[model samples]
Target: MNPSHSHPLRIGVFDSGFGGLTVLRALLRELPQAEFLYFGDTARLPYGAKSRETIARYAVSAAEFLVRQGAEYLVIACNTASALALDDLRAALDIPVLGVVETGANAAQAHSHSGDVLVIATAATVESHAYATACAERNLRAVEKACPLLVPLVEEGWIDHPVTREVLSIYFTELMHQSKAAALAPDTLLLGCTHYPLLREPIEQAIPAQIRVIDSAEVTAAQVAAAVHAPQAGTPAAPRFFATDSPAKFQRLGSRFLGQPIEHVELIDLEALEAL
Candidate 1:
């Protein structure tokens, strides 16, 4: 579908929790004038722990809700949902749906000359090997490592803490060793989690200076903006925020992710939609 710049675009960003706010933050910066509808399925958080079928069902419901709200474009901002339910979402929705895994893989493909890339994400995403498959399709070799502790550390508001850096140091040390043992000279590191963007500063500092770090949220936003055309100047509309549960937490943590105040958030009942 051709995204025309003739009018304001209603873009939907969906995630299982507040982490995906980083993607919306990037989108807001890239297309500040466009309308945004963000939904966090906090009622059923940690989609990584769910089965493939359940994940597909939950994601499709979120996509349907956004489409009904007049979302012309859909951005699956959750790495777990993107890894497991992207195809289901595209089949279920009639609009253009973009996922982070593919975008991150594309970025790696473009940045790598050695055809070897490194990915660090949650345990569930790493187990899915979605990044590996996406990289393979682009003729890139990828080594995926699960930094299971980083998510909690980020959520705990320890972005620049010494403990966070220590954990990251260990993860990077192990990742580099693993990649070398695999006989892959990886020159690019892909942050496969939306929450990882918040830790980009520390991550970049921890990784080798020569390795190019790719943030999935930033890359996805760049791709969406490129596809949707340039931003326009007008009285830009305030983004609409929704969460299946915990509007307060969404607003609180979301403000941190967006790097600005999140004025209000609406609580949604996606349970009814899931049963539909």
Candidate 2:
């Protein structure tokens, strides 16, 4: 589809939880002229640990919900859901569906000349080898690490707190140790989880200065911009926010990710997805 002809594109972004706000924030910044619909499945969050079948079901439901809400394009911001359910979602939805893993992997490959890349995400994302597959397709090496505790830490707003630092030290130590043992100390590390970006400061402090950290949020935003139709020259587009639950909490936490206060957030009933 010619996105440039589709003015005021209605873009949809979904995550297992609030972490997807990271990607939404980036998109809003990159494409302020585009309209957006954000869906956070806080009712069924932490999809990282779920089974593949379960993740697929959730993804399909989320995509259907967004489509019903009039989304012209869809962005699956959850790494776990993207890794396990993207194909299913594409088959089930008519709109163009994009995922963070592929964008992140491509960014990592482009930034890492050494062919050494580290991916830190949830257990499901790591186990799925999504990053490994993306890198292998380009004949590059990638190390996958799962920092399960980091998501909760970020959600709790402990980005630069002492506890966050302590936990990060432990995770990074293991990641670095694994990389060194494999003789693949990556020059770039992919923050595969949206929540990871919230902890970027602490993560940077824990890792070596020589290593570069890549946030998929920007890459995903660029992809969304490329896929959506550009806005008309004189038209103004406003971003919209939606959540399955806790609009107030989403708005409060969203400000941190969005870098500004969200004017309003609307709550939607995800149950309507069953009909879609």
Candidate 3:
């Protein structure tokens, strides 16, 4: 059912870190009529290396927080959470929950003409084999690599730094070598983490041009647009941004992601999660 134009739909987006802002940016671009509530768990950032059980717990808490804020639908913008916690989240939330993994996997499958795909993500996501599972389900072959340091590098805003380039070379050399050794170079490389999108240019330069890189933000945004109930006309809703810590930093970084200033970012007390 379409949402009436008189009222904007409230969509909640959550991430373990600032990376979720990338997904939120795309969502805003695709669905300008909707209002968004973004929560970045900066205190517990980088869920990539955490245990599956731990990631799931954190994800559920974040989802519950968003729901409590009157979110009608939720987006798990963190690939780590999507990989390890999506099913459990879906069962727990009354509203429809969307994740980046499946949407990204679909995009990779569609663009990968060579039948070989490479997935680069955090340790947790790579270990979860979320992309591999999705590819297998679609009758495709997959190779997964974990770049544990990439997130920190991106967070430091070093995507264009010389050290970043050097690190990319080191990280991607193995994948390139493996593809060559397998006699099936991957035609597509999936930037399985949201933060990886910011490193696209460097990553692209480090890899062969024949290999296309896919980021889930765009595809996920399109899916969100399709799934949202249309907003009521003339209804304007403002976005509420929240961070577990460093509200000012979040606002600054969020403005970079959103392509506009985030006038206000509230600091959330995630310690409350323990009580819950």
Candidate 4:
């Protein structure tokens, strides 16, 4: 849908947790004048461990809530939900829905000259095989690795910590070994999880020089910007923030991902919706 420039566009960005703020951060760069409604389903986070049905239910409820709040577009920023419930979200919502997995794959297809790509994401995303499938659809062979610890480390504000760097090194080493074993020459490394972008610096240091890293948040935002047309040169208001639980903590840690101080985050109760 072409958003009218008469007023700021209300774009909804949904994530299992605040990590998706990275996507919002990128979106702000692409469409500075657009109004973003960011919802963090923190109460039911780690959608990675839940069953596919459960994840879809949680994500659909979140999406519906944003739509009710006048969201013209929906961006599924959580990798787990993007991997497992993207189709469910599109089916449940009338507005346009974009998932990071597809965007990441699209970026990988654009960057990979060797037709092989490596994906690093949360365990649930790896289990879903969404990146691999998306990449395959784009005719790019993808090797997915589940780096579960990275999420916690990133949330702990250890983006450049020695331990985080070491962990990244190990994961990249294992991914390279897997790629070699599969007899595929990988030219691109896709950060399949939103949290991974926080560690991009160390991640680049961990990988080979020739292999480029694709930040899913950046690509997803770029694609969304392209879809919604260019950003207008106007003073955009601060984004509206909502969280299922822990408004205080969300405000605290969310700032790290958003790269700005979030003045306030309205606490939302999704229990009634979850019950349905």
Specify the highest-TM-score model's number. Answer: 4
Query: Model 3 — which ten-residue stretch has the worst lDDT?
Result: 1-10
**Candidate 2 lDDT score relative to the true structure:** 0.84
lDDT of 4 at 59: 97
Between the candidate structures 1 and 3, which one is better when assessed by lDDT?
1
* Superposed Cα deviation of residue 1, candidate 2 (Å): 3.4
lDDT of each: 0.91, 0.84, 0.85, 0.92
Per-candidate count of clashing residue pairs (backbone under 3 Å): 0, 1, 9, 0
Off by over 4 Å in 2: 3-7, 272-276
Could you tell me which residue pairs clash in candidate 1? none
lDDT over C-alpha atoms for residue 84 of model 2: 93
Top candidate, metric lDDT: 4
lDDT of 3 by residue, 1-276 (tens): 346534578899999877888899899888887889999998888787788888888888888989998888898999989999999899889998989998888887788887889899988888899999988887778888889889889878898899999999998898877767777668888989988888989999999888888878888998888877656355557789988888888887877666678889888887786586
Q: What TM-scores do the predictions have? A: 0.96, 0.92, 0.92, 0.96
User: Which residue runs does candidate 1 get wrong by more than 4 Å?
Assistant: 1-7, 230-233
Q: For candidate 4, which ten residues in a row score worst on lDDT?
A: 1-10
Candidate 4: list runs displaced more than 4 Å. 230-234, 274-276
Predictions: Cα RMSD each: 1.5, 2.0, 1.9, 1.4
lDDT of 4 by residue, 1-276 (tens): 664556678899999999999999999988888989999999988899999999999999999999999999999999999999988999989999999999999899888899999999989999999999999999999899999999899878887799998888898899999999999999899998888898999999999999999999999999998898534766787899999999999999999999999999988889966677
